[model samples]
Target: MKTALQMSLAAAASLSVFTATAAHAHVSVSGPAFAGATHEATFGVGHGCDGADTYRVKVQIPAGVTSVRPLDSTFGKAVLEKNAEGNVTAVVWTKPLADVLPADTNYYKLALRFKVPDAPFTTLYFPTTQTCRSEAGVETTVAWSDTSGEHGSHDADAGTPATSPAPSLFILPARSPGWNKYTVNQHVHDLSVFNDALIVWAGKAAYSANPATQSLITTEPDTEVLSEIHPGTEIWVKY
Candidate 1:
């Protein structure tokens, strides 16, 4: 019962909302974001291309990252592409069989661990391509390879293609002790091997690891002695 003008305006509003959602749904890489450290990068894929099923995801490794090892995924098989210098340059995870995955499966989370170079305060971009296959075997590729200006700014703009934004990680500066520091997203267990003289900063309080006791002891007696540090805890160790 709406007028033609009203209907056009409603459709435009819906389209704008859809575009904003799509722009924010681009593949993203997240991790400790520290330089000179071994970082586990998690590549998040929110959805597949349109209504298609994502069959494969390929991520290009930027320069200065080495010893790339893709984590195992229940949804797909991981493959590595090595350069002539025997260094990994890219990693691809492909579904072994379409029937093995759920019919409604669209989202994927892939991870890889690599050593970030000593370049501090730098942003690393991983250009990724997602291959979506329809039921009829039609393949569609969405490239997430834009590293211009600010992250997601270009894609969020109107008229930009959906799913053409690259995943980026902000490398933080290296800490002292000639060892890099990393802030994990969750509490870390099993710090037995790291029994050396290391420092852990939880909030404003600092705790040092006692090599003899293999425990983290607080500098201040009143401060809490932590067995397991919570998320956002920064630790500096000599690697």
Candidate 2:
């Protein structure tokens, strides 16, 4: 009773539903977006290789980031990386958790200290990974990709079978937190610790939204800056 295109869109929509049900498939960052503000970036875990327990995470801080630090927890460890320019630096840090990734739940948190730049516009990238103790804690890398500036594309699950082309995940844009201050809280969700920003790509422009709205925020960036948030550049996680 439906045309091929209609059936295809229906399938795509179905896949999106399936992915949301498996919300813990990837690790992400979220929180408020004010400079010198510390927020919690939550790393989610679900449906990965069976027996795979998320152990360590590495977050790459983009240029123009300031006052970056990880919170101390049962699974907290981190370090800072200074840039060649000296003024700019990326926070290359990792942490160990008390609990491993649960079989059917999202678990993890990280306390992060971050200051937005002076500029009104900028991009932040976060490249992260999860390790399973079974492989001597072999790190399973989680790649970051963003639509150039397009909005609302990641309507499907990462593990779902594709019947059509998938919408790309795009990194959002953020503004500098000049003199303003925000607070970071530590809480356990599902089974993982999370402490970071939630970056949302709503449309042509990217903006960091509150992680609480992760369900509403879109991850598709515009097509122009397709590779701007490439996996290797470090994922600047902000919500």
Candidate 3:
């Protein structure tokens, strides 16, 4: 029989997986989440709204993101909507010659390239709106604007609605030469492979002495800090 502690740990792990799956259960954006980098943001449209065929999609550009340009798609014609300041605020893609395509065949995937802001350790949410037109000339709109709380507080049990949900990306800090950020689920042996790299956990930093060892040590060489880190730990390393 499993102990009480083991049972509780297993339940928590299961909940974590469920929550992550639920968060990405809508139209999502994919790209490099590095700060101040030029990247292609691909917006994936899984299906049409309800039973109607999606004819148009509009993605709101976040304030700090600039130089927005949508890529041409064979499924639709891309249009850029600019504000009075001449900054592109939104990019809309609409099916070309709607009458030519069958109502059931109106689906699309859109992409745009832009420069991410210089903000690090921040999350960016892009709210999207999808417009669908039924065979009877009826129009339906679905908005993907739901967001987490101000400080990135996520509600695991929050039920997702029929409408789309916003897609988000986390921006990381700029790294020095040979340094990179990695998310790990378990222990990472061979810390010495990366010279002068530090392990950061919960805002605390630790270093290792014998780089060839399988574990990391605290600032004090006599004290050992960790051999295996907690799951879902994000660490910055030079390797």
**TM-score: which candidate is best?**
3
The per-model lDDT (C-alpha) reads 0.62, 0.36, 0.59
Residue range 1-239, candidate 1, lDDT tens digits = 12432343334333321011122336877743656889888888888876777888999999999889999787687899988999898999988754433343656889999999876534577989988887777788988887654553321232443346678775555555434566644434423223332434444444333332213233334445444555566754432
Clash totals for all candidate models: 0, 54, 1
**What are the per-residue Cα lDDT tens digits for candidate 3 across 1-239?**
12432343334333321011112634677743567988787888777766777878888998999988899887587899999999999999887545433355544568899989986545577888888878777888988887643212222312334234577655544566444776654333323222233333322444433332224233334444543344567765532
Error of 1 at 81 (Å): 0.5
> In model 3, where is the ten-residue run with the lowest total lDDT?
14-23
In order of appearance, the predictions have TM-scores of 0.58, 0.42, 0.63
Off by over 4 Å in 2: 1-25, 35-50, 84-106, 121-123, 135-139, 145-239
Model 2 residue 3 lDDT? 44
Ten consecutive residues with minimal summed lDDT in candidate 2? Answer: 186-195
Best by lDDT: 1
TM-score ranking from best candidate downward = 3, 1, 2
- Model 1 local distance difference test score: 0.62
Error of 3 at 132 (Å): 0.7
lDDT for model 2 comes to: 0.36
